[model samples]
Target: MDETAQEKKLSAHNASPTQASDHPADPVLSGGFRFDRMELAGAFGDLGTLLPIVIAMILINNLSPSSVFFAFGLLYLLSGFVYRLPIPVQPLKAVGAIAIAYPAVVTESVIGASGILFGAFLLVVSLTGLMDWMAKLFSQAVVRGIQLTLGLVFLKKGIELIIHKDLFMSGAQNRLAEYPVNLIIGITVFALVLLLLDNRRFPAALAALVVGIGSGLALGGFSTLTLAFGPTDVRLISPSMSDYWTALVMLIIPQIPLTIGNACVGTASTCTSLFAGNPLLAKAKAGMFALTMGIVNLPAGFFGAVPMCHGTGGLAAHYRFGARTGGAPIMIGAFFILIALVLGELGFSLLALIPRSVLGVLLVFAGLELCPLLRNLKTNEEYFVALLIAGIALAVPNMGWAFAIGIAVDFFIRKMNVRI
Candidate 1:
């Protein structure tokens, strides 16, 4: 071809079609689907991290799995449709998986949305650009105090899962001998989880979940079939609205801040730290995030479920694996919903089979993995922060002023001219 013709062809190839077109289906930039090994891993890895948490939450908290399912479903939908920045939503999952049960144990009913409320608190701060402003009023000591508290919250719960495996079981201590089947199932699931983690072929938690489901089916776990789509006298019994109101009221004081504060200081921070090396992306959408979860959770609650949240720990795991964006949450959330709905009894029964010892071992490994974070705290300020946070987490139940205590500690440290 002639030089002029060749130059014209090169120019055509170089120019974006949208730049040249009068109208385009979408801007050319929209066509590319970004993927990274760590982000993708983080997204997909959440399933494994979330499963055990789900099991523990369900059994210990006596919260409905439906709530978790709906919450997550909404979270993912909102992450994509609203936030538009596909940050992983696993922090809430990790937190909920561990903490939801405790609140349920206290309240005697499942609760939802408190975590979202907490997130809303932070979301408002972030959206209004107040985190930067608040950053000044508190010294590093105060922030570290909050960080330490968050870490210990996770660590303490991790220890509890391992140490008190039978605390949430159905029968009394004397009837333990009758639950050989449950022990076997639980132990097996725990072992399977470790095996999967070692191999990294499939997710450890998801593998455990599958094994639990299979075992449940084998053991005739679904024998007591009750729930379905149809509205009948048999299946349509409503949860006492008064009881629900009481539960919500009971949860309000604790959950709203717990969920929202944790999201800002814990989940957002974790994801930000984990994805530090990644390319710049837009800030996540807020209203859509809330709307997405609200859409699913409102329905799921009526059917007996706990509210779910995206967990940071779970998100970190996904990043370690290879999930790129919101796509991973969609997959995990959908899978969870399917299990809770179509295979409810089977899934629960399977989870019930895990052995306490094995479960303990799994949680212990997870907790130990966090030791390096402690090592990174080289300053006295960090030490103070970590201990203070852990202490409040330990004391919050016994002391009515956990938040006040944390703040007081921070104030005292700041007044003393501590440098962290």
Candidate 2:
């Protein structure tokens, strides 16, 4: 996007003339909800990142959808009230992807174990001030590198969702539509989103969902729908050493860098830039975010909910789509709470109503939202490190390895006084 368009996308509300919100954080000033068309549209901004993973885990891992939904709702609520911005809550992408790809090794229990284990690590870093010390180790170039890698990853997944058409590796047995049909729906929604993306009167996300849901219903979304009220029975988690081992290798190591670098530090940076001058966003710090994510997951491990994070991509999605105040997360949170209460695990069937094509559109935009952040990189050396990190992560398809390489390279560059 050009500078003007990027500015519009980052503005508090696309239609509103102010960078500060209409309520300007409201009667409380530092924290409150502001309901409006923009906030409503922004509410579902990250569903692209959310629904697929949860549904797949529920189907593949046999975790309770009700508890997953409930956990998400509560987490979103916490993000809104505490952060006072439309920051987001999402499943750990690396962990979710690992479980989905290798269900045999990374079972539901393994995922739950990851939640507990990683949550504990986050607490240690956050509470004991280790996060501050660790934060110093990650240079801006490395952080941007991490964010760039994720943006590219989202873009890839978005494309796959479009082409595969069967809920990320669901295969021929579960493929929903033929290639042509999938293409048409995805293209139509994508075009519509681009055209109406900045329009306040008819918000882009809301419009895209309307088409998605309508298309899904037309394709027989109701035939499989059944009411199954939930927050289903919670089971006490008792993961074995093997489970913890798998969780650490496949989920924790691969994913923890993201929660710390992007979710915590990178998101704090995004908040400072996007919500500058807003008092409500003043406390949006890396340590606090680290703590909040641990809080999001500790209770989750007991019920086998997916591990959660405050991904910067989700925040970019909300802001790009017009979320301004706390209302956005609250709106999405309440919606999920209702889904858990009313539809329970069966809500997955209903969500299937919205086609993968539509969801792909969401993923594409959310990924693209991160592009602007990269423009902040100034020096050639910073750009080189960031690009190298992104290339290694995407090429290896392993963030854990990429992060280690990034740190070593950044340190070498600083020590050698190397000039790119």
TM-score of each predicted structure versus truth: 0.61, 0.90
Clashes of 2: 0
Error (Å) of candidate 1 at residue 201 is 3.1
**What Cα-based lDDT does every candidate model obtain?**
0.45, 0.78
List, residue by residue over 1-420, the lDDT tens digit for candidate 2. Answer: 012334335544333453455554352255657788878898888888898888889778988777788889998998988887988998888888888899988887898899999888888899998887777777878877877887888898888777654532222122354446666788889999999888889999999889987776666566666666665555667899998888888789888777777788878767765765567656788888888888878878877888998977888788778787788999999888887777665665667567787888898998887865677666888888889999998888667678778888999998999999
Q: Pick the candidate with the highest TM-score.
A: 2
TM-score, candidate number 1: 0.61
Give the distance in Å from residue 335's predicted Cα in candidate 2 to where it truly belongs. Answer: 1.3
lDDT of 2: 0.78
**lDDT by residue (tens digit), candidate 1, 1-420:** 011333234323323223222223322124223333333333444443445566656656556655555455556655544332344444344235335545633332334334433444445655566654543333333334444554455456545544553523332232343455555555565566556553434656445545544554454434433445322221222545555555455554544444433433344444334333223222422222333444554554444444554434444444334443455555555655565566565544544544343444333344433333343344686577656655776675521244446556667776897676
Clashing pairs in 2: none
Minimum summed lDDT over a 10-residue window in model 1 is located at: 228-237
Clashes of 1: 39
